[model samples]
Target: MSVLPLIFTSGWASGINAYAVVLLFGVFGATGLTDEVPEALQRPDVLIAAGVLFLCEAVADKIPYVDSLWDSVHTVIRPVAGAVVGALLAGQSGSVPELAAGAVGGSTALVSHLVKAGTRMAINTSPEPFSNVIMSTTEDLGVAGIITFAIFHPVGAAVVAGTLLVLGTVTALFLVSRIRAFLRRRAQRRAERRAGQAVGPPV
Candidate 1:
């Protein structure tokens, strides 16, 4: 069977948390849970780096506005990670062209990343911080679950990932107005802060 399904699932997960995907895949590969993961990801240094970054993200992703800032930084990283992982998977499997797999993975990751980032922006508008923590935890669990499942049942996991991608996109679209408003308010607040600093206590 083609490795496309696994690639698709990984891409979807990568959008939300690329480091987690790498860490999990590395652990699974090192433990002999599966051989589909590329050797580069199984290296001890790679696993350690991914683990540390995953820890950083886990903390940063639970903070209200901080999560949004982190997402902004990862806009390019996530998609690129997805493409590289996909190409590596294709090379290992030899069941699909590297370019095709990379394209699929990169595009899927980009779409899902947008959905995640947009949704987080909308969530950030909430006054309480609990929502950010809840959402972040849920995303982490969802990524871990789907990646684990993909190792056992690639096509089924792909279906789940695809369904989630669609639902998330739709939800993000529904919350577009809120996200826009949030951005406006945040920008305005930053501007006000800057102005205040510039005035320097009216001196």
Candidate 2:
């Protein structure tokens, strides 16, 4: 039951459309992004922080090197978030069991982060803006679903997560394959276009 809550809550917290935001939060500090979004951006700090992070994500996602940079940073992030949240919760109840729970929580976050990074890498390989948008949207939906499950039914969330973790792995492989094919096709098309232009369209 406890494990379920951790999984579900973490899952939901991993947003799809808000992946960059969530990831940034994970990279920077978990609390800022883990809690609910602020009701108003009236506060200067909140507004500025949000803007900077979002912009960084926007620019980073587009630049190949920067995308790698984001991945490198986030590699340490997700696990920390999981660990922090777990530790906080464990503090509430001082018990050996609780300590174990915290470890589990932190580990879960790490696993989630790895899966997410894999997906982003696959998605970013394509130069098509639409593909990134679509994948991002899909990720947001997955995160939302996990959150909803945590709130409503934890048992269900665990089952779903276990299933998805397996599926996510498969999906990662599939995405990698598709992205490679797409890149290859794009390169061929670009070469053809350049060749045609050089020949003056064969008159």
Write one digit per residue (lDDT tens) for candidate 1, span 15-128. 999999999999999999999998999999999999999999999999999999999999999999999889989998999999999998888999999999999988887999
TM-score of 2: 0.57
lDDT of 1: 0.94
For model 1, the superposed segments whose C-alpha errors exceed 4 Å read 179-203
Question: Can you tell me which runs of candidate 2 are displaced by over 4 Å?
Answer: 1-4, 7-68, 93-96, 174-203
Give TM-scores for every candidate, taking all chains together and pairing residue i with residue i.
0.88, 0.57
- Tell me which residue pairs clash in candidate 2: 12-147, 16-139, 16-140, 17-140
Candidate that scores best on TM-score: 1
